[model samples]
Target: VLKGVVYISLSDNMLYKSGSYEMSDQAGETLNKIAKIIKDYSNYDVLIEGNTDNVPITSKNIRNNWDLSALRASSVVQTLQNKYGVDPKRLTAGGRGEYNPIADNSTEAGKIKNRRTQIIITPKLDQFMDLIGKAPEKS
Candidate 1:
């Protein structure tokens, strides 16, 4: 059983076209599954983080890896909020550019693996206050 929350990593190829932030048609099914899971757990907040390979991006729209990664993350966030109706307050988007890689960037396969997104589901801390125990009131 999950102790607190679930974490899912989605490859960029599964969500967006190469070098573009536009969500692909296949992304719909994936997002749908995520939405159902999020709906079941109202006490958790979702963090969507986008990552990129170390290769330099020189596209007209995507100036650098930072912009590419950030826009990708924001695109996913928008889809979740607008298409799936997830609570805006419970979602956050982050971009890691090419700085945090789970695989070596020397190989094509590894680079492919590095270009991905991570969805982190964490339980809200409000319910943990009792477990943490409150401080004594100031006298």
Candidate 2:
């Protein structure tokens, strides 16, 4: 957890097969556990962010890392809503592609680290918005 937000990073290998957005059976089990936690925390919103290594990719369906990343995130979000019964309004899906690298992409280990899906859970914005509304304006 960081700054009141919980970050759960799942490696690409855990969620998908090589170069594909299709979630594995193991991914379903993992997501089932995550869904339980999400249900336990009703006031938090989930952000599914997908990241990829710097390696270029071209497949029958996926054109590039950006497309792959977005598709991966969307897959997770859809599963969470449709399969796990998470509220659709509480989820957001995004792709970082190769831009936001937590590790150097020059090494195999780094590339492995770069290929990940981050599930960021944060409290809803209602309290924050209320705080902002109550703040006094300066001249």
Candidate 3:
């Protein structure tokens, strides 16, 4: 296909242990699948976005859900780069916390659904050969 992209939704139940950013074994496997997609679609960019429930983190340093989400996203980005040889430059790590919840936060199930880490793979705009002539030069 011409436009290659992979968007995978990792539910909160499939994530790392509570209060940690390390992915579970199954989550690691999912990350592996993501890595393979990156390797398969050469010249691609990966966006690792972390999301969290409306609940706040009472941990010592994790003052808010934002910290938790951001850290999780960073952790995933590190995993892809360190374990899978994915170029660091091609990866973007970010977090939406409870701001971009995909589900309601009023119930346990909804909160669980609200928490997630989305791995989005897409062709890098600047690296696309086909877009070479379509894009305006920087200078």
Candidate 4:
């Protein structure tokens, strides 16, 4: 956790097949664990961010990495809401494409490291605002 927010990073291979946005068969068990966390933190909002390596890709359905990343994030959000009963209002999905790489994308190992999904859980904005309002004002 950072600054009162919880971040959970899941490797792409754990969630999807190579170059595919469809969740892998084994993704359910992992997602179930995350869903449980979301349910436990009722006051927090969830952000699902999908990221990819620098490699270019083109498929009949996916035009590029951006499309793939977005579709992947949306898929996770849908599953969390539809299957896990997480509140739709508390979830947000974003795609970083190949821009936000946590590791070098030059080698195969680096590329593998770059492909990931990050689940961020943070307290609601209202709670943050309330804390800020209670702080001492600058002179």
Candidate 1 local distance difference test against the native = 0.89
**Deviating ranges (above 4 Å) for candidate 2:** 129-139
On residues 5-77, what C-alpha lDDT tens digit does candidate 3 reach at each position?
6787887557677766767777777778778878887778888899999987888877788888889999889
Candidates' C-alpha lDDT? 0.89, 0.91, 0.82, 0.92
lDDT of model 1 at position 116: 97
Model 1 TM-score, all chains together: 0.88
Q: Backbone clashes in each candidate structure, one number apiece?
A: 0, 0, 0, 0
Report residue 95 deviation for candidate 4 (angstroms). Answer: 0.4
Cα lDDT tens digits for candidate 2, 30-75: 9999998888878889999999999998798798899999999999
* Model 4 CA deviation exceeding 4 Å by range: 131-139
Would you list the rank order by lDDT, best first? Answer: 4, 2, 1, 3
C-alpha positional error of residue 49 in candidate 4 after TM-score superposition, expressed in Å: 0.3
What TM-score, over all chains together, does every model reach?
0.88, 0.90, 0.83, 0.92
Better of 3 and 4 by lDDT: 4
What range of 10 consecutive residues in model 4 has the weakest lDDT sum? 127-136
lDDT value for model 2? 0.91
Q: Deviation in angstroms for 71 in model 4?
A: 0.5
Candidate 3 achieves a global lDDT of 0.82
